[model samples]
Target: MIEFIITALEALALIAMAALVFNSHRNRFLNRYFALFLVFLALWVLCGFPQALVQEPSDYFITLVFRLAHCMAVLATGIFFLFGLGFYLGRAPGRTWRGSVLLATAIMAFCSLSDLIVRSVSYDQGRFYITNGTAFPLFPAFMILCGGGGLLCIALKRRESIGPDRARATYILLGFGIFLGLAILLVIVLPGIMGSDITSDYTFFLVIIPTGFTAYAILKHHLLDVRLAIRRSFAYLLTLIIFGAPIFLSYMIFRFAFESHPNLETAISIIALALAVALSPSALRWSNRIAARLFFSGLYDEVGLLHEVSSIFTSTANIREGLAAATAIICDALGLKQLQVAIPEEATRGKGNWVIGCVRREKDILGFQEVEVSASPLFLLHDPMLLDDDANAGVVEDVRNAAMLLEMRSRGIIACLPVRGPGGNVGILMVGRKVKRRALDPMDVDLLHRFCERAGLFIENYLLSSYLLSMFEELSETRKRLEESDRFKTDIINVTSHELRTPLTILNGYAFMLQDHYERFAEDERRQYLTYITASCERLNAILDQFLTVSRFQAGAIRAALKPTDLLELLAEVKAGFIPEQGRRIESDAIPLGVRVLTDRSYLLLMLKNLIENAIRFSPSEMPIIIKAEEKEREVMLSIHDFGEGIAQEELQDIFQPFTRLEEIDKHQVGTGLGLYIVRLIADLLSVTVDVESEPQEGTVFRLTLPHA
Candidate 1:
């Protein structure tokens, strides 16, 4: 009867697990695999139920059923192994590995079809014996091969690629090891010692070992969201044990009594039934009490309550709410009449310091009191509130004063704790005695101290949260101002482009007309017109290019085609194209001709052109603009030196910013204020560094450091 009950419960659990797997099928792979395993386990249990009920030897029908069940279990095990391997690979069984799974499944199926796997079976005295033939060795070999395949697949995964999923693989390997070890022991070692007759019952335990491991793996790893299923199974098993055990025992007792006394059988059975019925409520209550006491002890409940209090403290933004919640928790936990928390007046007055304020409480019993001070304001002034000989003096005086006041009223202090936040001495917490003449115990003091420490953390967190919120508000306002400024800059660039283009076009047209018609005029007139037109057109084109580059960079449309090119060649091209004034000498030292670098050649050329143009525009007509290059460790350094009115120290930092030009320099040198900005942007994209050194009334040197090829 007991075996039947166990089988029934196992079956129900299996069905429930199946339903869960089907419901969560789309969500988890492990559940589907484990659910199939449970189905086979349930069938295996059912096959043994009839034999257990009859207390008889096994028959051909039962043997056939058991063999089928074993086949199912093996197939389920193999599938689970493959699924575990797939999980490690971060994919489902793909073409690369699916053949292995199919081959293993086919081998197991063929083995099941051949009777040679378990040649013969016999039973005696509730023991079933199975004789394994040569084919039996192949079964173990097949299992080992499947397990090896899983291990190999996992080993192939790159070490860096293996993430948290490695833990699931470990679980799978462990479960397989346990299952395989127990199977071998039962089939080979146990039968030799205990004889084959004892194999049937022991073999069931071997199967259970692997099943239990699989269940644990599923629960711990959430391998298919099977944790909920496991939890529900536990709950169901507990419910059955609690409600079913007493009734089952009572029924057995009544049956024994009736069989022993035939004359009084009916009466005794009725009395037993009546007693069981009468005790049902008490039995349930007792069971509930026992279970609750085991699972939900008072200490556990208290811990849970403390956790809830902690959550409230952490989640709340209001300081007053946190303080109130803390006070309530302490008062309730300690069973105190009143709890008072005080912050030091002096601590709050300082910029970022906090001191323990004074804590006050009323004495009870006709409003009379005998007050005992736990901590004082002076004690908190030391920050940590250390209770030493030197620090205790002020505390002792405050206690004396409180005692005097209490002598007039009549209430005693229970305990006092100093509260500290990150900034130190945030407050002091005090609890009054529940009854007159009662003093605080060691446990009370410990609890209060812990509560105070937690309260301190909460207060500190609150202050930090407030500070963060203020910072966020300031950042939001700053971001808004920046957005508006950027939009205004864009508008100014658009208006300037239109305004500058019209005048430049007319100037170029008239200059070109004079240069063309000057054949009938003087040679000097033609030369002057050509120079003016060329210089004006070049300046205008430079301004337009800077603006276009800046807009493209800001819009994230700039693309760099990087290749190995000589820096000297690129710089030379820029110099030859952008001719400086006649009297302004441009000089280049003998740079390494073939020093190749990997960068966008066009952007590099543009950057060098900007530097040379800026130098020539700012320097005096007769001064020389020098370009030099030298190789450093892992980098090539290039410098463009200008003998110009140098930038001021205060303005050096702002020189690279857009629309920022030297206030003391020539105002007539038409520039869009974007040349330096574009230069900096291109350098940044190439992972290069740009630095400028200058002194007032001297000269400025712009340096570029590029990674050496």
Candidate 2:
């Protein structure tokens, strides 16, 4: 019974070790060494469980399985030593190493096939022994040579520049060192102390300590952020352990309690089995909670960090302050030494090129680095040369290079992360060494990536806010200048109207007096004086009206009063009102008499007057001004066509703006240039459409459409 218990325990341990080895094969450093460790473990278990090996014919098959498993383990150990040496030196083992591995594998294969390496093997009285063969001593020497070579390579690698990853490498080497030392001591000194015969089982226990330590380092130490797999493995093992322990204990207790009676023993076994079955659900739930807490600590921490970052982003308008808050929060949470926030430099050039906006824990004040984008020849992956001895160097260089390269290529990298929010790469967030100067583990990288991704969104939003703030400031300054200019324009209009209107009013009084009281004057002279006074008064009135309209529009007080009016009559009256002058001709066309329109009569009149007046002022003395009123379906169309030096197509759109006049026009026109602008405002309020078709030096046409009554 004791022997069976020992065999069962050893079997469980061997199975556990095999599972660990299988998992380790999927990893980098653990891949090669784990297989060998499993072999040694299996050998130890088998040596203890010799009865199981001889209990049945199937036991022979089991022994053959173990023998094959042992060979594989030995071969893996030899290869792993060479591979580990190469990894430590930061380069692959050269041709010499490959040749040695291949030669060793071939020789081991031949020995296994010929049985020459183990001359004779016999099993008697449930005890097995192996007779030493020709290559027995040589095999031990090979093992020593491989183990010693690994140590030597590790020593050489230590002499080179060691960064944050050095400590992790040290832990691995120490584990190997302990195993190697134990192996050598067992091979050389154990036989002398414990008689002539030596067995593999005695040395197996020493391997468990190093293997346990290695498993811990790989799973918990963030060795390249591979924590999830480790955590899952631990959870699986824990579940099994929790379930198996009670069963094992119950088996032992029941065996003792019913040792004297076969029937009692069967009854106790059944009861224990029933109890284990009933308690499994509770065990599973407990194990699940423990696993979740262990694996998702970073996730919980990130949720809190995201909230803090979001608050900072929304409340702050200052770009630098926002960046500082974001970077500091992330760095503190993730245990990073440095952080950088960058924006595109070519953003000012109308193309988005990235520029470093801010940096934390950097020696250079000019944190901005220009990135060159390329395609075809991709940048190296995490260049080893970039790593600096200082904790910040590797992270800084890695992040900078990654950010620049990603931005250039327009690809995303989640190199390290829980990625703060979404999965897309926002920007690179590099993490420096931990407090203990150790390299970032896989979990750390995942968490950092998540944080940076979330923080990147915040950074983008802050930058947008910053841009909007700048635009608002510019608009405010422009408004101030416009207000000042309006005041100055009002002053000029007030002074000029006062200065010109007084003379025109006095001249009109004189002309009326001359015509009424001085009848003896010549007819031609009287007529000339009357004409001069009339022209001056009209010109002055027009100027004053233009200024008033512009001032009203600028003050946002322009409104139109809509009323029904006769369109044909209004046009005829306006045509008759224009006095014929030398070298000026006015042409007018009237529509049907009943053609009526619901519009702001005053506004329509003003619009027509401005269009006619503009055509006359710009046209040559011989050019005819054509004004046509026509009735179209549901609307009245009024067109003022001018045969004059017309406007360019480009300037047509700006013609209606106040104070805007054609650059090519003669500068002697007496008008404030607000006629077209007031016309547009009046049209808009009455829901009228105004369109102009103009071609340089050909002629221009102004068309207006008002709703018909």
Candidate 3:
């Protein structure tokens, strides 16, 4: 009767778990593997029932059905591992995972079919047992590979997993770890080492526990996206209820048979039932552990977890992101409660290394506190030789160098691992005490060391790559500037040659006439010719002065001598330079007495002169060039406005560019375009700002606003 109950429950669990994955969202890779696993589990359970019945003289052809069922159960082992790989990776199984499944299933098939693993079932002590054969050892070896491999894959990705993913992985490691431990003891250790028979009754527990957890994960969805993958867990759970419901009816039938007869056989069974009821409290706890489906809550796969942490170096763009990821891995793998990471000063290229800040996990509450610290020689900790100091006597200087040291120690920081970059150590990876508050073991340190080595090199390379990219961009920009400069030089030479040739020709003609035909020529003609030569000389002198100004500024020979002077007086003088017609079109107010400024006197004058000249050239003959002055707080404004053809908005910015003459401006205009460019150079030299506002068909205004010296 007890065997019947166990068999019925196992059958229900297997069928429910199968329908849960296969019925809905079966297209999911993990679900497909899980569904396949359920099929084998159901087959094993059905076969076990017949094998157990061998005690009843005829266990439904146990020789054939029992042997195939053992093979099929081993086949489920491979499928379960594949499911885990897909579930934990949260992706489809790759070629490697698929190949492993095929290889394992093939080996199980050969051994089971050839009777090399389990030759026959034996009925003894009113129980059926599957006795091992010569090749039985090979079965456990296959189990180790599939089970260990799946777990390793989970660990490898744990660092990147978060929220539901992390929780799911944690459950898998814990639950499956218990399963593995039990399988080794029941199938390998007890049989191979103790040379005992394998009981058919206890074998179902291994499959039942993991199946329960998988069903739960599917129901919840987030841990493994139940909505996307396992939409039918509740349906399966209902099915379990439907199938296992007969167990209570059978119990009632047994109660009637035992109570009505009251024989010696029935009396022992009743006493056992009474003891079970009495010890229900302890049984409830064990049942809960079994129902919860994992012996440990947060067990970690050490090697895989370290791989997950090392991957952060290649995966994240910055130290902050990498450290955040590393923190999660550390907490999960090493069971650290709180973690603190500090970046070195040299990485930021500063006085001291900075604290990348702190992350504290109190219970499940995880948060970051950004507290920056400076100047600690903690980079020396990168050697991997340093161990935790009980009293911290050796690290007194480090504490002195960094004030946050005492606070960190108080918080139970166990080890300071240096995160090294190309330039020595980039930061400090400070870990706090373990979650269990135990000192770190050798394995923990070694894992950290390996992770840090990979992380540091990868981070250094990222920084190096970023730096190289920036330098390349800067070099490209510098090349562009040089090209523009070359173009400007070419334009200057063309304009200068044309301007110079015309003046030199005039001077040469005038000199020849005055020297050879002085007596023959009229006095007035000679005087007019002499005047032309004098004008030509002055024009040449002006051009030469412009050239000299350009050369002086370009070579950084000019310096500003700032002193208090009347800006209004200077503007009045400049306004006088541009004479007006009878109507006084060039208008101005009375010069203020104390509108003083501190600027290079000559540079300021040059700026004012250029604005007046530009205005005169662009404005029409009928319109006057206006020089307007206004007083402002802490500064004075001098405006040069032209009432003629207004400058276009698009070309306003370029007016200050050297030798930049607009096509709209009169081609017959007599001056070189260097006036405004010279003004720009002078303003920059003297620490003055020059701005312009203009519109086509309206007038242009050049405003010179300077601060008081």
Winner by lDDT: 3
- Candidate 3 lDDT at 363 equals 53
Query: What is the TM-score of candidate 3?
Result: 0.53
| Alpha-carbon lDDT of model 1 | 0.62
Q: Name the lDDT value of residue 409 in candidate 3.
A: 64
TM-score of each: 0.35, 0.43, 0.53
lDDT of 3 by residue, 229-330 (tens): 232233334334543344445556667766756685476567656755665555444444443343233334445677787777667777666766776667
lDDT value, candidate 3, whole model = 0.66
Worst 10 residues of 1 by lDDT: 363-372
Q: Model 3 off-target regions past 4 Å? A: 1-345, 348-374, 378-414, 421-424, 432-451, 576-586, 589-592, 662-666
RMSD of each: 26.1, 19.4, 15.1
Error of 1 at 667 (Å): 3.2
Question: What is the Cα-based TM-score of model 2?
Answer: 0.43
Candidate 2, residues 87-124, lDDT tens digits: the string is 57554567786687758865774564344444554454
TM-score of 1: 0.35
lDDT of each candidate versus the true structure: 0.62, 0.60, 0.66
Per-candidate count of clashing residue pairs (backbone under 3 Å): 13, 24, 9
lDDT per residue (tens digit) for residues 414-507 in model 1: 4445677767766666556553333443234545666777788886676667667878999999998698568648855664765477558857
Which residue runs of candidate 1 sit more than 4 Å off their true CA positions? Answer: 1-531, 580-584, 662-666
Report the lDDT of model 3 for residue 316: 76
